[model samples]
Target: MQITIVSGKGGTGKTSLAVSLAMTLENVQLLDADVDEPNCSLFLDLDTKLVAEAKIPIPEINYDLCTLCGACSSNCEYNALMKVPDQILVFEKMCHGCGLCSKICPENAITEVPRTIGYLYEGENKEFLFNFGSLIVGEELSTPVISQLKQLISKDKPIIVIDSPPGSSCPMVETVIDSDYVILVSEPTPFGLSDMKMVVKTLRILEKKFGVVINKDGVGNEELELFCQKEEIPVLLKIPFDLEIAKNYSKGVPFLNVLPEMDSKLKKMIVDIGEALE
Candidate 1:
Protein backbone atom coordinates (compact mmCIF):
# COMPACT_ATOMS: atom_id res chain seq x y z
CA MET A 1 0.00 0.00 0.00
CA GLN A 2 1.14 3.54 -0.82
CA ILE A 3 0.62 6.04 1.97
CA THR A 4 1.20 9.70 1.18
CA ILE A 5 1.82 12.13 4.01
CA VAL A 6 0.98 15.74 3.16
CA SER A 7 0.14 19.07 4.74
CA GLY A 8 -1.98 22.07 3.82
CA LYS A 9 0.87 24.48 4.45
CA GLY A 10 4.59 24.42 5.12
CA GLY A 11 6.29 24.11 8.55
CA THR A 12 3.67 21.73 9.86
CA GLY A 13 6.05 18.81 10.50
CA LYS A 14 4.90 16.95 7.37
CA THR A 15 8.35 15.65 6.40
CA SER A 16 9.22 14.83 9.99
CA LEU A 17 6.13 12.72 10.43
CA ALA A 18 6.64 11.03 7.07
CA VAL A 19 10.21 10.07 7.91
CA SER A 20 9.30 8.80 11.32
CA LEU A 21 6.42 6.76 9.97
CA ALA A 22 8.60 5.19 7.31
CA MET A 23 11.23 4.23 9.87
CA THR A 24 8.53 2.65 11.99
CA LEU A 25 7.22 0.46 9.18
CA GLU A 26 8.88 -2.75 8.00
CA ASN A 27 9.87 -3.49 4.40
CA VAL A 28 8.69 -0.08 3.24
CA GLN A 29 9.73 2.40 0.53
CA LEU A 30 9.85 6.09 1.32
CA LEU A 31 9.65 8.60 -1.53
CA ASP A 32 10.16 12.29 -1.04
CA ALA A 33 8.02 13.81 -3.82
CA ASP A 34 8.61 17.42 -2.76
CA VAL A 35 10.90 17.97 -5.73
CA ASP A 36 11.35 21.68 -5.14
CA GLU A 37 12.66 21.07 -1.59
CA PRO A 38 13.21 17.43 -0.68
CA ASN A 39 14.67 17.08 2.84
CA CYS A 40 13.84 13.57 3.97
CA SER A 41 17.42 12.52 3.30
CA LEU A 42 18.65 14.80 6.07
CA PHE A 43 17.32 12.54 8.78
CA LEU A 44 18.44 9.23 7.32
CA ASP A 45 21.94 7.77 7.17
CA LEU A 46 21.59 5.64 4.02
CA ASP A 47 24.14 6.02 1.22
CA THR A 48 22.22 7.23 -1.79
CA LYS A 49 23.22 7.11 -5.46
CA LEU A 50 22.04 9.05 -8.48
CA VAL A 51 19.30 6.93 -9.98
CA ALA A 52 18.05 8.97 -12.95
CA GLU A 53 17.93 12.45 -14.39
CA ALA A 54 14.42 13.77 -14.81
CA LYS A 55 13.86 15.39 -18.19
CA ILE A 56 11.06 17.15 -20.01
CA PRO A 57 10.74 17.70 -23.75
CA ILE A 58 10.91 21.33 -24.85
CA PRO A 59 10.48 22.68 -28.35
CA GLU A 60 13.58 23.42 -30.40
CA ILE A 61 12.90 25.47 -33.49
CA ASN A 62 14.87 24.88 -36.67
CA TYR A 63 15.17 28.36 -38.21
CA ASP A 64 16.22 26.88 -41.56
CA LEU A 65 12.88 25.12 -42.06
CA CYS A 66 10.71 27.65 -40.22
CA THR A 67 8.14 29.70 -42.07
CA LEU A 68 6.78 31.82 -39.18
CA CYS A 69 3.27 30.78 -40.25
CA GLY A 70 1.97 31.37 -36.69
CA ALA A 71 0.39 27.90 -36.61
CA CYS A 72 2.53 26.78 -33.66
CA SER A 73 2.02 30.03 -31.78
CA SER A 74 -1.75 30.06 -32.26
CA ASN A 75 -2.18 26.47 -31.14
CA CYS A 76 0.01 26.70 -28.04
CA GLU A 77 -2.25 26.71 -25.01
CA TYR A 78 0.54 27.83 -22.65
CA ASN A 79 1.63 30.72 -24.92
CA ALA A 80 5.14 29.26 -24.93
CA LEU A 81 5.45 30.05 -28.61
CA MET A 82 5.23 33.56 -30.04
CA LYS A 83 5.55 34.50 -33.70
CA VAL A 84 7.52 37.62 -34.50
CA PRO A 85 7.88 39.05 -37.98
CA ASP A 86 11.37 37.63 -38.43
CA GLN A 87 11.22 34.39 -36.38
CA ILE A 88 9.37 32.27 -33.85
CA LEU A 89 10.39 32.79 -30.26
CA VAL A 90 10.27 29.74 -27.97
CA PHE A 91 9.88 30.38 -24.24
CA GLU A 92 11.31 27.27 -22.67
CA LYS A 93 9.99 28.07 -19.21
CA MET A 94 6.40 28.45 -20.38
CA CYS A 95 6.36 25.20 -22.33
CA HIS A 96 4.51 22.27 -20.78
CA GLY A 97 6.17 19.79 -23.18
CA CYS A 98 2.80 18.77 -24.62
CA GLY A 99 4.28 18.63 -28.16
CA LEU A 100 1.21 20.39 -29.52
CA CYS A 101 3.26 23.14 -31.17
CA SER A 102 5.44 20.58 -32.93
CA LYS A 103 2.43 18.60 -34.12
CA ILE A 104 0.64 21.68 -35.45
CA CYS A 105 3.68 23.25 -37.14
CA PRO A 106 3.19 23.47 -40.89
CA GLU A 107 6.89 23.43 -41.82
CA ASN A 108 7.88 20.79 -39.25
CA ALA A 109 10.39 23.33 -37.92
CA ILE A 110 9.79 22.45 -34.28
CA THR A 111 11.55 19.49 -32.74
CA GLU A 112 11.34 18.23 -29.17
CA VAL A 113 14.51 18.11 -27.08
CA PRO A 114 14.95 16.68 -23.62
CA ARG A 115 15.71 19.28 -20.95
CA THR A 116 16.99 18.16 -17.58
CA ILE A 117 14.60 19.47 -14.95
CA GLY A 118 15.54 17.38 -11.92
CA TYR A 119 17.45 14.38 -10.57
CA LEU A 120 16.28 11.24 -8.76
CA TYR A 121 18.24 9.47 -6.07
CA GLU A 122 17.86 6.07 -4.43
CA GLY A 123 19.20 4.74 -1.14
CA GLU A 124 18.57 1.57 0.79
CA ASN A 125 19.58 0.18 4.17
CA LYS A 126 18.49 -2.91 6.12
CA GLU A 127 15.28 -1.10 7.15
CA PHE A 128 13.71 0.35 3.99
CA LEU A 129 14.36 1.90 0.59
CA PHE A 130 14.47 5.67 0.17
CA ASN A 131 13.97 7.72 -2.98
CA PHE A 132 13.72 11.44 -3.65
CA GLY A 133 13.64 13.99 -6.47
CA SER A 134 15.51 17.27 -6.56
CA LEU A 135 14.23 19.91 -8.96
CA ILE A 136 16.80 22.01 -10.70
CA VAL A 137 16.95 25.65 -9.75
CA GLY A 138 14.86 28.02 -11.91
CA GLU A 139 12.59 25.16 -13.02
CA GLU A 140 8.98 26.19 -12.55
CA LEU A 141 7.47 22.83 -13.48
CA SER A 142 7.78 20.19 -10.72
CA THR A 143 5.19 17.60 -11.66
CA PRO A 144 7.43 16.08 -14.31
CA VAL A 145 10.19 15.58 -11.76
CA ILE A 146 7.72 14.07 -9.31
CA SER A 147 6.36 11.81 -12.02
CA GLN A 148 9.85 10.54 -12.74
CA LEU A 149 10.55 9.95 -9.05
CA LYS A 150 7.39 7.86 -8.56
CA GLN A 151 8.41 5.61 -11.45
CA LEU A 152 11.25 4.35 -9.23
CA ILE A 153 8.89 2.71 -6.77
CA SER A 154 9.61 -1.00 -6.38
CA LYS A 155 6.74 -3.43 -6.83
CA ASP A 156 8.22 -5.80 -4.28
CA LYS A 157 7.75 -3.44 -1.36
CA PRO A 158 4.52 -4.03 0.51
CA ILE A 159 4.32 -0.49 1.89
CA ILE A 160 5.30 2.84 0.31
CA VAL A 161 5.35 6.13 2.18
CA ILE A 162 5.45 9.32 0.13
CA ASP A 163 6.42 12.67 1.60
CA SER A 164 4.40 15.09 -0.50
CA PRO A 165 4.80 18.81 -0.97
CA PRO A 166 2.70 21.05 1.19
CA GLY A 167 -0.56 22.68 0.04
CA SER A 168 -3.30 21.58 -2.38
CA SER A 169 -1.42 22.49 -5.55
CA CYS A 170 -0.42 20.34 -8.53
CA PRO A 171 2.77 18.97 -6.94
CA MET A 172 0.98 17.73 -3.83
CA VAL A 173 -1.89 16.32 -5.87
CA GLU A 174 0.51 14.53 -8.19
CA THR A 175 2.24 12.91 -5.22
CA VAL A 176 -0.88 11.69 -3.43
CA ILE A 177 -3.22 11.02 -6.36
CA ASP A 178 -2.39 7.30 -6.50
CA SER A 179 -1.89 6.60 -2.80
CA ASP A 180 -3.97 4.03 -0.92
CA TYR A 181 -4.33 6.50 1.96
CA VAL A 182 -3.21 10.02 2.85
CA ILE A 183 -2.22 11.41 6.25
CA LEU A 184 -2.85 15.16 6.30
CA VAL A 185 -0.64 16.68 9.02
CA SER A 186 -1.82 19.96 10.45
CA GLU A 187 -1.36 22.11 13.51
CA PRO A 188 -4.27 23.16 15.69
CA THR A 189 -3.89 26.87 14.89
CA PRO A 190 -6.36 28.95 12.91
CA PHE A 191 -4.18 29.19 9.81
CA GLY A 192 -3.60 25.44 9.99
CA LEU A 193 -7.32 24.79 10.19
CA SER A 194 -8.03 27.11 7.26
CA ASP A 195 -5.44 25.45 5.04
CA MET A 196 -6.48 21.98 6.14
CA LYS A 197 -10.04 22.77 5.15
CA MET A 198 -8.90 23.55 1.61
CA VAL A 199 -6.98 20.25 1.47
CA VAL A 200 -10.02 18.41 2.82
CA LYS A 201 -12.13 19.90 0.06
CA THR A 202 -9.57 18.92 -2.54
CA LEU A 203 -9.30 15.33 -1.27
CA ARG A 204 -13.08 14.98 -1.25
CA ILE A 205 -13.17 16.10 -4.87
CA LEU A 206 -10.52 13.55 -5.78
CA GLU A 207 -12.41 10.82 -3.84
CA LYS A 208 -9.32 9.99 -1.71
CA LYS A 209 -9.50 8.35 1.71
CA PHE A 210 -7.61 10.45 4.28
CA GLY A 211 -7.23 11.21 7.96
CA VAL A 212 -5.75 14.07 9.96
CA VAL A 213 -2.72 14.16 12.33
CA ILE A 214 -2.71 17.26 14.49
CA ASN A 215 0.83 18.41 15.29
CA LYS A 216 1.66 20.75 18.20
CA ASP A 217 -1.61 19.70 19.70
CA GLY A 218 -1.56 21.71 22.96
CA VAL A 219 -1.13 25.24 21.62
CA GLY A 220 -4.08 25.80 19.34
CA ASN A 221 -7.75 25.90 20.22
CA GLU A 222 -10.02 22.86 20.10
CA GLU A 223 -11.76 24.23 17.03
CA LEU A 224 -9.65 22.06 14.74
CA GLU A 225 -10.63 18.91 16.58
CA LEU A 226 -14.22 20.13 16.64
CA PHE A 227 -14.11 20.71 12.88
CA CYS A 228 -12.78 17.20 12.32
CA GLN A 229 -15.50 15.74 14.51
CA LYS A 230 -18.18 17.66 12.64
CA GLU A 231 -16.82 16.54 9.27
CA GLU A 232 -16.56 12.93 10.46
CA ILE A 233 -12.86 12.89 9.57
CA PRO A 234 -10.93 10.48 11.74
CA VAL A 235 -8.37 11.97 14.12
CA LEU A 236 -5.57 9.50 13.63
CA LEU A 237 -2.77 10.74 15.89
CA LYS A 238 -1.69 13.84 17.79
CA ILE A 239 1.88 14.94 18.50
CA PRO A 240 1.91 17.29 21.44
CA PHE A 241 3.88 20.53 21.61
CA ASP A 242 7.39 19.77 22.82
CA LEU A 243 10.55 21.81 22.78
CA GLU A 244 12.84 18.78 22.74
CA ILE A 245 11.17 17.43 19.61
CA ALA A 246 11.70 20.73 17.83
CA LYS A 247 15.33 20.88 18.94
CA ASN A 248 16.03 17.34 17.78
CA TYR A 249 14.32 18.02 14.43
CA SER A 250 16.44 21.15 13.90
CA LYS A 251 19.52 19.03 14.55
CA GLY A 252 18.53 16.70 11.70
CA VAL A 253 17.25 14.00 14.04
CA PRO A 254 14.09 12.02 13.55
CA PHE A 255 11.56 12.44 16.33
CA LEU A 256 11.18 8.70 16.55
CA ASN A 257 14.75 8.56 17.84
CA VAL A 258 13.97 10.88 20.71
CA LEU A 259 10.40 9.81 21.35
CA PRO A 260 10.71 6.06 20.93
CA GLU A 261 7.53 5.63 22.95
CA MET A 262 5.48 6.96 20.06
CA ASP A 263 6.69 4.12 17.84
CA SER A 264 4.01 1.77 19.12
CA LYS A 265 1.32 4.40 18.49
CA LEU A 266 2.47 4.88 14.91
CA LYS A 267 2.50 1.12 14.34
CA LYS A 268 -0.98 0.85 15.75
CA MET A 269 -2.17 3.62 13.48
CA ILE A 270 -0.76 1.83 10.47
CA VAL A 271 -2.47 -1.38 11.53
CA ASP A 272 -5.77 0.45 11.91
CA ILE A 273 -5.37 1.95 8.41
CA GLY A 274 -4.61 -1.49 7.01
CA GLU A 275 -7.76 -2.90 8.55
CA ALA A 276 -9.79 -0.03 7.17
CA LEU A 277 -8.38 -0.61 3.70
CA GLU A 278 -9.34 -4.28 3.86
Candidate 2:
Protein backbone atom coordinates (compact mmCIF):
# COMPACT_ATOMS: atom_id res chain seq x y z
CA MET A 1 0.00 0.00 0.00
CA GLN A 2 1.11 3.53 -0.81
CA ILE A 3 0.62 6.21 1.85
CA THR A 4 1.34 9.90 1.30
CA ILE A 5 2.06 12.18 4.24
CA VAL A 6 1.23 15.86 3.65
CA SER A 7 0.42 19.10 5.40
CA GLY A 8 -1.67 22.17 4.69
CA LYS A 9 1.32 24.45 5.31
CA GLY A 10 5.05 24.19 5.89
CA GLY A 11 6.81 24.00 9.28
CA THR A 12 4.20 21.63 10.65
CA GLY A 13 6.56 18.65 11.02
CA LYS A 14 5.29 16.99 7.85
CA THR A 15 8.67 15.64 6.72
CA SER A 16 9.62 14.62 10.23
CA LEU A 17 6.49 12.56 10.69
CA ALA A 18 6.87 11.03 7.23
CA VAL A 19 10.43 9.88 7.90
CA SER A 20 9.59 8.51 11.32
CA LEU A 21 6.60 6.63 9.98
CA ALA A 22 8.69 5.13 7.17
CA MET A 23 11.29 3.97 9.67
CA THR A 24 8.54 2.44 11.80
CA LEU A 25 7.19 0.35 8.92
CA GLU A 26 8.93 -2.69 7.43
CA ASN A 27 9.84 -3.35 3.81
CA VAL A 28 9.04 0.23 2.79
CA GLN A 29 9.89 2.54 -0.09
CA LEU A 30 10.06 6.18 0.93
CA LEU A 31 9.77 8.95 -1.66
CA ASP A 32 10.16 12.64 -0.99
CA ALA A 33 7.98 14.40 -3.54
CA ASP A 34 8.59 17.88 -2.21
CA VAL A 35 10.81 18.83 -5.15
CA ASP A 36 11.14 22.49 -4.12
CA GLU A 37 12.34 21.67 -0.60
CA PRO A 38 13.06 17.99 -0.09
CA ASN A 39 14.43 17.50 3.45
CA CYS A 40 13.50 13.88 4.15
CA SER A 41 17.08 12.92 3.32
CA LEU A 42 18.33 15.06 6.20
CA PHE A 43 16.75 12.71 8.74
CA LEU A 44 18.08 9.48 7.24
CA ASP A 45 21.66 8.23 6.83
CA LEU A 46 21.57 6.74 3.35
CA ASP A 47 24.33 6.86 0.75
CA THR A 48 22.17 8.51 -1.89
CA LYS A 49 23.25 8.77 -5.54
CA LEU A 50 21.92 10.92 -8.34
CA VAL A 51 19.98 8.35 -10.32
CA ALA A 52 18.17 10.48 -12.89
CA GLU A 53 17.54 14.02 -14.02
CA ALA A 54 13.96 15.33 -14.17
CA LYS A 55 13.31 17.10 -17.46
CA ILE A 56 10.49 18.86 -19.29
CA PRO A 57 10.12 19.56 -22.99
CA ILE A 58 10.14 23.27 -23.83
CA PRO A 59 9.46 24.73 -27.23
CA GLU A 60 12.55 25.80 -29.15
CA ILE A 61 11.95 28.29 -31.93
CA ASN A 62 13.93 27.65 -35.12
CA TYR A 63 14.42 31.04 -36.73
CA ASP A 64 15.70 29.51 -40.00
CA LEU A 65 12.40 27.80 -40.86
CA CYS A 66 10.27 30.44 -39.18
CA THR A 67 7.77 32.96 -40.18
CA LEU A 68 6.98 34.90 -36.99
CA CYS A 69 3.40 33.74 -37.29
CA GLY A 70 1.49 34.41 -34.04
CA ALA A 71 0.06 30.88 -33.92
CA CYS A 72 2.53 29.52 -31.35
CA SER A 73 2.32 32.57 -29.11
CA SER A 74 -1.47 32.78 -29.22
CA ASN A 75 -1.99 29.13 -28.33
CA CYS A 76 0.42 29.11 -25.38
CA GLU A 77 -1.51 28.96 -22.12
CA TYR A 78 1.46 29.93 -19.95
CA ASN A 79 2.55 32.91 -22.11
CA ALA A 80 5.94 31.20 -22.53
CA LEU A 81 5.98 32.29 -26.14
CA MET A 82 5.65 35.88 -27.40
CA LYS A 83 5.80 37.04 -30.99
CA VAL A 84 7.64 40.28 -31.73
CA PRO A 85 7.78 41.86 -35.20
CA ASP A 86 11.30 40.51 -35.92
CA GLN A 87 11.28 37.25 -34.02
CA ILE A 88 9.55 35.01 -31.48
CA LEU A 89 10.78 35.08 -27.89
CA VAL A 90 10.75 31.92 -25.79
CA PHE A 91 10.68 32.33 -22.03
CA GLU A 92 12.05 29.04 -20.76
CA LYS A 93 11.14 29.50 -17.13
CA MET A 94 7.46 30.20 -17.74
CA CYS A 95 6.89 27.17 -19.96
CA HIS A 96 4.85 24.27 -18.55
CA GLY A 97 6.21 21.99 -21.30
CA CYS A 98 2.76 21.16 -22.62
CA GLY A 99 4.07 21.05 -26.26
CA LEU A 100 1.04 23.04 -27.38
CA CYS A 101 3.18 25.77 -28.89
CA SER A 102 5.01 23.29 -31.09
CA LYS A 103 1.79 21.58 -32.15
CA ILE A 104 0.06 24.86 -33.03
CA CYS A 105 2.95 26.33 -34.98
CA PRO A 106 1.78 26.55 -38.64
CA GLU A 107 5.34 26.83 -40.05
CA ASN A 108 6.69 23.86 -38.07
CA ALA A 109 9.31 26.31 -36.76
CA ILE A 110 8.94 25.15 -33.17
CA THR A 111 10.69 22.05 -31.86
CA GLU A 112 10.53 20.54 -28.40
CA VAL A 113 13.75 20.25 -26.41
CA PRO A 114 14.33 18.65 -23.04
CA ARG A 115 15.18 21.13 -20.26
CA THR A 116 16.52 19.81 -16.97
CA ILE A 117 14.23 21.05 -14.20
CA GLY A 118 15.28 18.83 -11.31
CA TYR A 119 17.32 15.84 -10.14
CA LEU A 120 16.18 12.50 -8.66
CA TYR A 121 18.24 10.61 -6.12
CA GLU A 122 18.02 7.03 -4.87
CA GLY A 123 19.44 5.48 -1.71
CA GLU A 124 18.93 2.16 0.05
CA ASN A 125 19.99 0.56 3.30
CA LYS A 126 18.83 -2.68 4.99
CA GLU A 127 15.63 -0.93 6.17
CA PHE A 128 14.05 0.60 3.09
CA LEU A 129 14.56 2.09 -0.39
CA PHE A 130 14.63 5.88 -0.67
CA ASN A 131 14.03 8.34 -3.51
CA PHE A 132 13.70 12.10 -3.57
CA GLY A 133 13.58 14.95 -6.12
CA SER A 134 15.16 18.39 -6.00
CA LEU A 135 13.96 21.20 -8.23
CA ILE A 136 16.56 23.37 -9.94
CA VAL A 137 16.69 26.96 -8.75
CA GLY A 138 14.55 29.42 -10.77
CA GLU A 139 12.21 26.71 -11.99
CA GLU A 140 8.64 28.07 -11.87
CA LEU A 141 6.82 24.73 -11.89
CA SER A 142 7.40 21.71 -9.62
CA THR A 143 4.66 19.34 -10.82
CA PRO A 144 6.82 17.97 -13.66
CA VAL A 145 9.65 17.10 -11.27
CA ILE A 146 7.16 15.49 -8.88
CA SER A 147 5.70 13.54 -11.78
CA GLN A 148 9.11 12.20 -12.64
CA LEU A 149 9.75 11.28 -9.01
CA LYS A 150 6.53 9.27 -8.70
CA GLN A 151 7.59 7.30 -11.75
CA LEU A 152 10.47 5.93 -9.68
CA ILE A 153 8.16 4.25 -7.17
CA SER A 154 9.17 0.59 -7.05
CA LYS A 155 6.10 -1.47 -6.20
CA ASP A 156 8.47 -4.21 -5.10
CA LYS A 157 8.12 -3.05 -1.51
CA PRO A 158 5.11 -3.97 0.60
CA ILE A 159 4.61 -0.39 1.75
CA ILE A 160 5.32 2.99 0.12
CA VAL A 161 5.51 6.22 2.08
CA ILE A 162 5.56 9.51 0.14
CA ASP A 163 6.63 12.76 1.78
CA SER A 164 4.57 15.30 -0.10
CA PRO A 165 4.93 19.07 -0.41
CA PRO A 166 2.80 21.24 1.89
CA GLY A 167 -0.39 23.05 0.92
CA SER A 168 -3.28 22.19 -1.44
CA SER A 169 -1.55 23.30 -4.62
CA CYS A 170 -0.65 21.35 -7.74
CA PRO A 171 2.60 19.94 -6.36
CA MET A 172 0.99 18.48 -3.24
CA VAL A 173 -1.99 17.21 -5.23
CA GLU A 174 0.29 15.54 -7.74
CA THR A 175 2.11 13.76 -4.93
CA VAL A 176 -0.91 12.40 -3.04
CA ILE A 177 -3.52 11.91 -5.77
CA ASP A 178 -2.47 8.35 -6.52
CA SER A 179 -1.75 7.18 -2.99
CA ASP A 180 -3.85 4.48 -1.36
CA TYR A 181 -4.12 6.72 1.69
CA VAL A 182 -2.97 10.18 2.79
CA ILE A 183 -1.90 11.23 6.26
CA LEU A 184 -2.58 14.92 6.85
CA VAL A 185 -0.27 16.31 9.53
CA SER A 186 -1.36 19.53 11.16
CA GLU A 187 -0.68 21.56 14.27
CA PRO A 188 -3.54 22.63 16.56
CA THR A 189 -3.12 26.36 15.96
CA PRO A 190 -5.63 28.56 14.14
CA PHE A 191 -3.51 28.97 11.04
CA GLY A 192 -2.95 25.23 10.96
CA LEU A 193 -6.66 24.56 11.23
CA SER A 194 -7.43 27.05 8.43
CA ASP A 195 -4.88 25.49 6.08
CA MET A 196 -5.93 21.98 7.02
CA LYS A 197 -9.49 22.86 6.14
CA MET A 198 -8.37 23.79 2.64
CA VAL A 199 -6.56 20.47 2.28
CA VAL A 200 -9.59 18.63 3.61
CA LYS A 201 -11.75 20.26 0.98
CA THR A 202 -9.28 19.32 -1.73
CA LEU A 203 -9.08 15.68 -0.62
CA ARG A 204 -12.84 15.42 -0.50
CA ILE A 205 -13.03 16.76 -4.02
CA LEU A 206 -10.49 14.23 -5.21
CA GLU A 207 -12.33 11.42 -3.39
CA LYS A 208 -9.22 10.43 -1.46
CA LYS A 209 -9.24 8.55 1.86
CA PHE A 210 -7.33 10.46 4.55
CA GLY A 211 -6.91 10.90 8.30
CA VAL A 212 -5.39 13.55 10.56
CA VAL A 213 -2.28 13.51 12.73
CA ILE A 214 -2.21 16.54 15.00
CA ASN A 215 1.42 17.48 15.67
CA LYS A 216 2.18 19.83 18.58
CA ASP A 217 -1.23 19.04 19.94
CA GLY A 218 -1.01 20.76 23.32
CA VAL A 219 -0.49 24.36 22.23
CA GLY A 220 -3.53 25.05 20.12
CA ASN A 221 -7.14 25.49 21.18
CA GLU A 222 -9.67 22.67 21.20
CA GLU A 223 -11.36 24.05 18.11
CA LEU A 224 -9.30 21.89 15.75
CA GLU A 225 -10.36 18.71 17.48
CA LEU A 226 -13.92 19.97 17.60
CA PHE A 227 -13.81 20.63 13.88
CA CYS A 228 -12.46 17.17 13.18
CA GLN A 229 -15.14 15.61 15.34
CA LYS A 230 -17.86 17.57 13.56
CA GLU A 231 -16.51 16.54 10.19
CA GLU A 232 -16.18 12.91 11.23
CA ILE A 233 -12.52 12.87 10.15
CA PRO A 234 -10.48 10.21 11.91
CA VAL A 235 -7.78 11.43 14.26
CA LEU A 236 -4.98 8.91 13.91
CA LEU A 237 -2.29 10.09 16.29
CA LYS A 238 -1.23 13.15 18.27
CA ILE A 239 2.34 14.17 19.02
CA PRO A 240 2.40 16.45 22.01
CA PHE A 241 4.40 19.69 22.06
CA ASP A 242 7.61 18.55 23.72
CA LEU A 243 11.02 20.18 24.01
CA GLU A 244 13.03 16.98 23.41
CA ILE A 245 11.23 16.40 20.13
CA ALA A 246 12.09 19.95 19.09
CA LYS A 247 15.74 19.56 20.07
CA ASN A 248 16.11 16.25 18.26
CA TYR A 249 14.45 17.76 15.13
CA SER A 250 16.89 20.69 15.17
CA LYS A 251 19.82 18.25 15.25
CA GLY A 252 18.47 16.53 12.10
CA VAL A 253 17.26 13.53 14.07
CA PRO A 254 14.05 11.60 13.60
CA PHE A 255 11.83 11.77 16.67
CA LEU A 256 11.52 8.00 16.57
CA ASN A 257 15.23 7.69 17.43
CA VAL A 258 14.93 9.55 20.75
CA LEU A 259 11.30 8.69 21.48
CA PRO A 260 11.33 4.96 20.90
CA GLU A 261 8.02 4.66 22.73
CA MET A 262 6.18 6.29 19.83
CA ASP A 263 7.27 3.56 17.42
CA SER A 264 4.38 1.31 18.45
CA LYS A 265 1.92 4.16 17.98
CA LEU A 266 3.19 4.80 14.45
CA LYS A 267 2.85 1.12 13.62
CA LYS A 268 -0.68 1.05 14.97
CA MET A 269 -1.55 4.09 12.86
CA ILE A 270 -0.52 2.16 9.77
CA VAL A 271 -2.58 -0.79 10.86
CA ASP A 272 -5.59 1.47 11.39
CA ILE A 273 -5.08 2.91 7.92
CA GLY A 274 -5.01 -0.59 6.45
CA GLU A 275 -8.25 -1.47 8.22
CA ALA A 276 -9.87 1.71 6.93
CA LEU A 277 -8.73 0.96 3.38
CA GLU A 278 -10.41 -2.42 3.54
Segments in model 2 whose C-alpha atoms lie over 4 Å from true places? none
In order, the Cα lDDT scores of the candidates are: 0.93, 0.93
- Give the 10-residue window scoring lowest on summed lDDT in candidate 1: 101-110
Off by over 4 Å in 1: none
lDDT of 1 by residue, 21-71 (tens): 999999999999999999999999888999899998999999999988899
TM-score for each prediction? Answer: 0.98, 0.98
Model 1 lDDT on a 0 to 1 scale: 0.93
